[model samples]
Target: MSVSPTSQGQAAIFIPTPNYLFSASVNLGTPLAPIPLLEGGQRIVEPITGGTIGGPGFQATIEGGLAAPIVLNSGDGTKTQLAFIYAYGHAQDGSPFYLEESGIGGGPAQTTRIIMNVGGKFQALQKMYILAQPKVNEAKTLASVECYSVPTPV
Candidate 1:
């Protein structure tokens, strides 16, 4: 599938191939606090304690980050978070990296784009199209984060 964001009659935009990047189970610490509002909705601020990610030619350790997701209630016993993450880590070879993701948390099949930065040998990541899939646990203490890259032409 492809995306067509046209002005008048422009052609469809390019769709890159799904390039697997990495997958990891992100560990979380307790949230600082919940700022409740909107009649049962709240904003959650959780800390990303640690994790690991590896795929293809890279393997990295998750250092720390912040998770700030706005929880919205449907009034029907359902709630979902408008989630955002700022994660950082280091490659096994001592290369530092950072990743940012924005998507829904506590929902099924939710995927969103990833903005990443890398140093050392993995610097090519800055020029690639990336995506992330994250699933939060019931206790809100863990997230399984998987990232993918869409291969674009040079």
Candidate 2:
């Protein structure tokens, strides 16, 4: 008796790999004082005044943006949960790319950090395949970021 060669072969699996996208240096205006809520968390807003996003084959000028962040403290008051939604305008190749970012942060109140993911659509055709990858921006503040495109399953 003999076994088939196909039975012994392993299946091929495709996984995504991350590629560097762009680095953005954001300049944020003064944050509107936090508004405390009677029931819980506080609401904060910040303005994105100006910045630059650049990388190989692509670069953009950050025209404007806004961020609304909410912070909720645990009953014990030792830990906090943060959620934020931000949107920005990018001028690239004589067109506009509207980008939005959102994320959640949880940790000790004193050392909380945000790991944001970004997605956007362009008005004109461009190297969209690079943009389709999962883009992540991790930072304590929105001052600066290194963006990357990670692979995903189809």
TM values, all candidates: 0.79, 0.63
Evaluated at residue 130, the lDDT of candidate 2 is: 36
In candidate 1, what are the lDDT values of residues 9-126, reduced to their tens digit? 8876876668678887789998977898766689888999998888884589999998887888786877787878888999877989998888775565567677878878888888
In model 2, which runs have C-alpha deviations exceeding 4 angstroms? Answer: 1-14, 75-85, 106-142
Against the reference, the lDDT scores of all candidates come to: 0.80, 0.55
Candidate 1 minimal-lDDT segment of 10 residues: 104-113
What are the per-model C-alpha RMSD values against the true structure? 4.1, 7.9
Off by over 4 Å in 1: 1-15, 37-40, 75-77, 105-109, 152-154
Q: List model 2 lDDT by residue over 1-154, tens digit each.
A: 1222343576545556657667677767777888997877888887878778788534778777776667787777654545353545555655555565544555522222223223343332232333322222344344565555544455
Question: How many clashes in each structure?
Answer: 0, 0
| Reference-based TM-score, model 2 | 0.63
